[model samples]
Target: MRNKYAIVIICIVALVIIEKENNIILRVSDKLSQFRTLQMPETSSFVIIDDNSSYPDDIYSENVLGAREKGQKHILLMATTRSGSSFVGEFFNQQGADMFYLFEPLWHVEAMLSLGTNGTNSSTSPWVYRDVLKHLFLCDFSLLERFINPPPKDHVTPDLFRRESSVALCENQVCTPVIKGIFEKYHCRTRRCGPLNLTLASEVCQKKRNRVIKTVRVTQLDTLRSLLEDPQLDVRLIQLVRDPRATLASRIVAFPSKYQDWKSWAVNENVSVKEEEVKRLEGNCNNIRMSAELGLSLPKWLEKRYMLVRYEDIARDPMQKAAEMYNFTGIPFTPQTRDWILENTHSHSSGIFSTQKNSSEHVEKWRFKIPFKLAQFVQEICGPTMKLFGYRFVDNEQSLVNKSFSLLEEKKFHFS
Candidate 1:
């Protein structure tokens, strides 16, 4: 079944790739049509990369050879999954007319070119890298429209506008505007090691005339420190974050893996609700500790570079929050764009389920669904951290101490 599912997904992805590459121009997004589809809730931690997007061809017939932005705009939304990041990305995609939509870049990026442990003979070599980047630079924007508001039944939307993304001429076959740019054109030719340096890749990107590239992990902050440390690198970060509670709830599956010991992360359903608090608290504590470790490891310059976002605010009200996000990042937010967002912002959940249309409120539904013991454990372990976040415990240590003190007072009264 798993294999079948995987095959289905791959086939669907393949269809999208073919449709976009061969399709004609695109104009109004709403006028395009969808082919193969993925079942998605109105809200999910999901993104649609237009290049791999499939749609009914040609509604807008603008030629790319002479295409110009006329002051075209670009904005990259960077964030991890289950963090309201996709919602943010989608909002940017909704901006002024049809624009580029690069879904999670790192997502399954390994499937792209793999620079083997030492960059040698490998299956799915060099070509993977070329194809992935090509998709980014030249994916169909019109196909992406159906994704934003795919028809309720299966209607064709404004597709001809997609062809407008490119410039008229092939700029060196692979170096200029992506559509005709010619940098890594020969990527199909497997060249021996040492030539595919990061410096060259950055230069390639710069030459492409890209304004902003969106990715989370602060590539410059914590994880990619080594890459950023190189003297030749010049990287700007679009740091995005969400409320801790929401972030965790969204990643419950991944949280348990971070524990140093399985026992520390384990819980027994047989335990009383009161008995489970210890385990829940332990998990929350460890999660908090991990974030702290990452924060501490973060470069001092990172704090200044980041724009903090509480996912809750985004989920509750995306327009206002998206505006704040754009404002903080120094990206312009106009009424037309804002109006677009007001019209198209669909996600409602950045919590675990991460639906597509809106962010989720299941942030801490665990308090109710979790065993009482687990709840108590979480409270006890995360009490201090929760307090810092202004969360009050239903069962608190102070109450426990007060109860003990009351018993002592009664005993003293009887003795007297």
Candidate 2:
């Protein structure tokens, strides 16, 4: 009887111990569930990791996070070479001390990688272009230094392509101290500001409220999806397109040696439409049309991020278009920007890459320059692109040269 009583006592004691262990496990599981819930909120603003080594954690913590915290604005002025990009880019470049603008920084990328690649294909990978642009937008100039020939030493490069075009780089902090009288008029390259202190440029970039970069290197729009979707950046893209015939005419004059065959064809009027140069032009048109179509489609990622602006439209009314662009980018169209546009657009400076011009006359001057046959050839090849952008075709030379007969149709492109 005593042995039976002792066995019952042991059984009861075992049951009590198991109950306490079960309660402890349930309490631990509840605490773990709360921890997981806390982690969920961070998913909304996580860093995008492309490559571990290329984009170190420090860069994300410092630059990307900093930009996000400050709510900085980024603007990308995208266009083809000689498509009035330089002219259109000036609107953003001349937006006073608040804006930091980089003029064709990708020229260094292309130049560095041009070796061993066919001219038809991009010498550098599109990802390289995108990466460089991404860093630049975030005010991180370290990545771009890799492409600078002779490489930047201690973050200084004298050979930054077209350094003078960027007023931000030319001004006080980035360039050397200006002499009181003798060197007062000169700035940047002419000023002989010592090798560009890229570190200082980055510091200036961080101080500005806005960053704008103009590039002809980004041939396709979709390649920018990663950049557009980045949680850290509020990027706005403006794609400036000109009539292909006008672009070709401008290229023939601006890059005569490169377009020697086109020049000869313009003079001789005997080149076949199937020539390699003509085929290249056709490819360029198709790329532009494809990108425009994608942007106009209003995909979920591109909502309110993409804008297509015709060079002709801006040339027609510089101030109005400038205001529209500023409004689109959520920037205040300052009086300084307005004044600069009024002065520059009316000026008659016609250098190959000069942004200042009587834009109204410059838009149609191509008709007089390009031969009738060449213009027709461009129309035949770039017809779909031209039509999509509202450029009307000329039936004959009489219609082409008639200044009163406008080639532009009353068409509007809208994006969400």
Candidate 3:
């Protein structure tokens, strides 16, 4: 009996020892895996070659001379996804008859090129894209109307235009009916009009003092150099940038169905969100750096013609920013513009991109919504670009203090 009891005791002790050993092994394995993940390659495939070389002086003179002669005011808002371009576009869209705003007209061309439709393939070439855009900026919408007439439902449907936007264009007589195939008789509307009655649209478009286009598709600044070089067109650029962390966080929350891969970037259900934020941080940093570099390299004529606007700055003080932008473009800052800004930014909304909050609140709301660790990770990734843009970094200490203060405030509110 004693010997049996001894054996039982020994077996129990051995089981406990084995369990402890297994636990140690697991912990070590976990640590090593974490170490490996952190060590994974951080370098990105995208690179920006800083071409700061100036273009010939004669080129600038010819283009400026031509723009003055033609009396054109062409403005392009070059931006990327989640960069508040829609907000800027809508803001400009409210300028009424003074400005004609086109939203992502290149979306169809990009879609067609991606789908290999109409014998177009991935290798269709950059010149094709450039030429299409060049003709597009000139108010020649024949090609633009083809994609809209049939309605490239697969990529960009005409219904993307808000009812008010469509009505505004129609009121201006820029041929919104062209998209619906209702105005075929007015096909000979403008000198640059295409087969689709784009002439009527072009004629109305020409009357507007400012012809504005907002697109997030242009990867290289040089893509629009040809249009800039054209003497007849008075082209200007608004390079819009936003805080990458906020942009990425907004994208992850808002575009779950579209950016499917973002969900996988989180460590937990939320870790993929952090990962996606980091990736976007890296990408936006690259883009912002390239834009700044390109702007510096531009010839004097093009350089003076471009403006860089931070979304946060504009959102914080829309009136001030609007006044400055108008002054820069030589456009009149009317009472209607201020009223529109107040109404649109504060009024009721129908879409995800609606601006329905106090401007400053909207700009700062992202900080509270994102997890501390996630924000820190993104900040680390976008540190350089953030610094360049004068954004305050969210450090660990700041995050902890913020959370503690938030908890205290919540408790105080409950007690009161």
Candidate 4:
């Protein structure tokens, strides 16, 4: 009887050991491949290891030595229109696996936030920007960029939402190496609570550096604080601002036709110093007030999750600025990442900002063309904000405020 009892006990122990080993493998394998169908066991309360692929690809196991070295951080780049955000984003895109280009997490966040499903008063224009970043990060979107410039698609639609892998969390096409050191804000409603293995995360898994998130709508301080609450999520803020003089000059010169009707009496939409319209536009600065409100919307609160970035610094030397940002986030900038930065940091090499797009280039050219008085007014109205970013305020030299066709018509000028 003793011998038979002992055999039964030994068999039970062997079964327990086998089950434990299987569970470990299950978890590890989830980080190795994409899983189309995943079902969690009732007993398991954490992320279930899921992989539709019976075999994994080499990309899953690829690691970067610098990543393991651990001295860099993730990047979150944000700014307003006419700012050099795209330039900054392009500069960071060269990080290989260590960095990701999250063009706009706001698109996605604002989309759901607008739904106000839980009482969030968000509008569609900006919220969609936040959520778009969330949607892209959760999935591999290399192919999506093939269609458009800056962004392949103009709008973030519901059809783009999907549940994918985050490598360490589980495997899928979304696996990338640079993120080993830092985490950008990636919102997934399905992600559950659990402890993370920092020891495992220390491994250098990508030859690239950390990731880049270029979602400018994230100016609200309250919004940023709420997003950074996730311990698993690392959100570093890179605030970008442009000089109002330069930005306004660029806007007018680049889009001269939009604001002005060259075909008729020229009028400065911003109100000319000499024309009756200057008072009209100056009196009703609602549009300017609204646009300026975006800057004012930034919460006065400060958090460690973010660092302010300047547009001039980026345009002057994107690589150097990128390295500084990488260091700020604590992500190692490997030689490989450095090389990627060297190769891909060329501004306007591609897209709407490309040489092919003369309209956008007008921004750079307007420095000489803008009439003195009009430029002065632009500086006067947007001076404080512009000076904050390094643009100089001009004196009211010659009141040759350039007028648009509409303003000219307002003057009731008779035809020759």
Q: Indicate which candidate wins on lDDT.
A: 2
Runs of candidate 3 with Cα error greater than 4 angstroms are 1-67, 117-129, 146-168, 172-197, 260-281, 296-298, 348-351, 397-416
Query: What tens digits encode model 3's per-residue C-alpha lDDT throughout 130-207?
Result: 544555565555444333434433232333323233223455354333344432322332222212234555666656
Candidate order by lDDT, highest to lowest? Answer: 2, 3, 4, 1
- Please list all clashing residue pairs in model 2, or write none if there are none: 304-416
Model 3: residue 292 alpha-carbon error in angstroms: 1.9
- The C-alpha lDDT values of all candidates are 0.37, 0.79, 0.58, 0.42
Tell me the alpha-carbon RMSD of every candidate. Answer: 18.8, 20.5, 18.1, 20.6
Per residue, candidate 2 scores C-alpha lDDT tens digits across 179-202 of 344322224743467667888998
Tens-place lDDT digits, model 4, residues 1-416: 99999999999999999998676445433422211133221312222222111212222222312322443344566666556675556555544455544455444344433333333443332322332332233232322221121222222211221211122222222322332334323322334312222222223223224555665454443333423332323446666665554555555545666445321222455433345434433432333333334334444333355455555555456567677766666666667656645555443453434322222333344445566655666655554545444455555433233221111111110111
Q: Identify the candidate with maximal TM-score.
A: 2
Using TM-score as the measure, what is the rank order of every candidate, best first? 2, 3, 4, 1
State TM-scores per candidate: 0.40, 0.82, 0.67, 0.47
Off by over 4 Å in 1: 1-78, 97-99, 110-220, 225-239, 242-268, 271-300, 344-416
Model 1 alpha-carbon miss at residue 37, Å: 41
Clashing pairs in 3: 265-272, 266-271, 266-272, 267-271, 267-272
lDDT-wise, the better of 2 and 4 is 2
Candidate 4, after superposition: displacement of residue 39 in Å?
21
